[model samples]
Target: MTDLKHLFFSLGLEQLDLSEKEKNIINAFIEQSTPRFNDICHQRQDKEPLALLLGYMTQQHHIASSRWIEQQTAYHQMQSVFQSSVGTEHASKFINQDVDEYILITLLWLLVQGANKIDYSYANEQAETLLAHIHEETKESNDSKEDEQLRQRLMQAFYQGKKTTQQSLFTKLKRMFRLTQQQ
Candidate 1:
């Protein structure tokens, strides 16, 4: 298994059984989200963007699997797991309002696709509810233009059944570390 997959498994997150195309889409989402996150947050932590997105997604999964009354506990437990696994600095940023909305909308879009391991039985209902929330919250805001464009592209790719090549997670992490050191 790749390092990312192993890390997720160790954290008791879902299996990383995504196809190359799905992995590419997720990578693209992270890449796209990073610049936007940095622009808004004013600080660039190498792993924070990925950690925030993945952590929130995992938290949502846990929440969906738990009873309503137990959701708060589940959310806190997931946060603790992410904090311990990815470092508190990276994981703590997952609670920002803007970041939460962005991740939620994007995650709901992915869940709606219904092609990945991220989908649970109630994922469709959850996705619809979250999407409606997003729409309601953003009704008077124009900041979602970029998000909409990204969503359009992702939807196009999904509908077209396009598959992209993927690199091993180990190599990507190694390269990321090398880049970080050189900076």
Candidate 2:
């Protein structure tokens, strides 16, 4: 029974600081969701049936919010892993905590969307994007004052609109996946 934290780190990945409680929660969620994801994948094959699968997930009304919250919790765990490792080395390099959080959140967003659609390719693309973002952000000395202000403003807007933020993010994601609202 490899724990979730070690599961991510076992492949030479940075370790996230996930508490025992969080491990239990995420592990349980993954365990519970695995069968359904497999079933959905089998049913859909590779067809781009946008609304049906998304609809299926949305229909799980009671647990929908739980899934998103769990996704967020897993993201925090991911951040903790990076923060515990490279965070100090890059702290003084102009990268702020909010930027780190944003990166992690975006990674999580891509991962969740891919998983929901049963598309590992999409997830891998997101991983590449995340790596690129990290490479760009960590070049601390190269960050101009303008970049810093933009980052700060972005973070501020994200935090200020906590409610619609998620909605807007989903909207953007829907577009990325070519999913229509009517669908």
Candidate 3:
């Protein structure tokens, strides 16, 4: 699987650049704290907190389509945890190190997935779940003019890259033929 940075470069497309304000508030903190996160994740001491840090950074980035990216990434990280536990699948087992390595790998996946311009549908599904957690703040968040603007920005970024899901003409005809035969 492609690593996180590579995923971002390809999928995020126009969302990677941080603005001056974002640079001041979020980018600075991530730049300062990433090494600490890397250490914790590497050491296998506590991965959750580190994952949260990475998640927040991803959401705040200009993914253009979804702000819930951090949570989605988190979900994927958890899924990998399950995958590592059994060690009965197609994955390699590093003896006792499966959990940590898998979680870290999943975290990287989210990072790159944010930068991804493709796979908008998967992002959309995950974004909805994240929005639910902010349900109470929905009115307050969207009521503000600035928040409204951000919503639009996110929609553009995430939606622009989605491939339409229409069925092919041949498939439609085949289905219709089957239905007619049944009648």
- Over 4 Å off, model 3: 1-19, 37-111, 114-118, 130-132, 138-149, 155-183
- Candidate 2 error regions (>4 Å): 1-95, 140-183
* Per-residue lDDT over 1-183 for candidate 2, one digit per residue giving the tens place of the 0 to 100 score: 333223223211222333465445445554564566556656987753333334443344224433443455455566567768778556344323343434434422332343344354544444444444544534324345654543443333223333233555787997977866556
* Model 1 lDDT per residue over 124-176, tens place: 45544444444454332445665465445434333221111122445688899
TM-score versus the correct structure, for each prediction: 0.26, 0.27, 0.32
Error of 1 at 168 (Å): 13
Query: Which pairs in model 2 have colliding backbones?
Result: 15-81, 16-81
In order, the Cα lDDT scores of the candidates are: 0.44, 0.43, 0.41
TM-score of 3: 0.32
User: What is the clash tally of candidate 2?
Assistant: 2
C-alpha lDDT of residue 102 in model 3: 25
